[model samples]
Target: MTEVFFYHLQSQPLEAALPTLVERSLERGWRAVVQMSSPERLSALDAHFWTFRDDSFLPHAPASEKGAADQPVLLTTDEQNLNGAAIRFLIDGALLPADSANYQRIVLMFDGNDDDAAAAARDQWKVAKAAGHTVTYWQQDPAGRWQQKA
Candidate 1:
């Protein structure tokens, strides 16, 4: 079984929140794979990870790139866990199939400002719950701290 988490982005964009969560995953000794809704987002995401912070960088590679197996973080457009990732991040309204047993956790990060993303998150919430996974919803408070809503 997988623990499915939904992160509703309001104050900060997904780009900012994703790396923070990925850092936590790395600290927990977990390899992470970020699945975008399409392949076109790969280059931009790769760049963003490298320069998201002036003093930090999240080491990552595209799934099709070389040395992916050695990367702690991977950006991809598919469900292939080539990097042996225990945690997976679903972004840009990407759909994760019902079979999530391969991963310990699956995170759905959607921008509440984007109508498509918000709608997608709602659809996925139903899918994940119907699939019998432990579903949880998290959102940032006024102070920009994470709080579990449901």
Candidate 2:
């Protein structure tokens, strides 16, 4: 069964947190696809990944780029998993795809400060649970560390 994780962003924004998660995914030898709600967000992330850190940048490419399947991390605004990733990261209000379970893990990150985002995460949580996936929820603490809440 797929393992679903819900990350509620409170102290840190998605931009501040995503790179670490993607890096960890890569360290685990897992390819990841980050699904965004819009092309603009995907574009922003594409640039951010290059300069997110002062010393190192995450190795990734947009799904439209050549050899997308060869990228360790793929950025996109579509439901298709062009990279055959082991994990999928859904952010910026991207809806969970019908074939979410196709991946080994599904990460749903939402802004905890936004009511709509929180509500959407709740709905997704219910759906994931109902679908029989192992679901867990994590919330950022005051210091920006994630603490499992449920």
Best by lDDT: 2
Candidate 2 matches the true fold with a TM-score of: 0.97
lDDT of 1 by residue, 10-109 (tens): 8887777888999999999999999997777888999999999999999899988888978999898878788899999999878875458789999999
lDDT, candidate 2, residue 38? Answer: 90
lDDT of each: 0.89, 0.92
Q: Which stretches of candidate 1 lie over 4 Å from their true place?
A: none
Query: For all the candidates, what are their Cα RMSDs to the real structure?
Result: 1.2, 0.8
Error of 2 at 125 (Å): 0.9
RMSD, candidate 2, Å: 0.8
Report the backbone clash tally of model 1: 0
TM-score of each: 0.94, 0.97
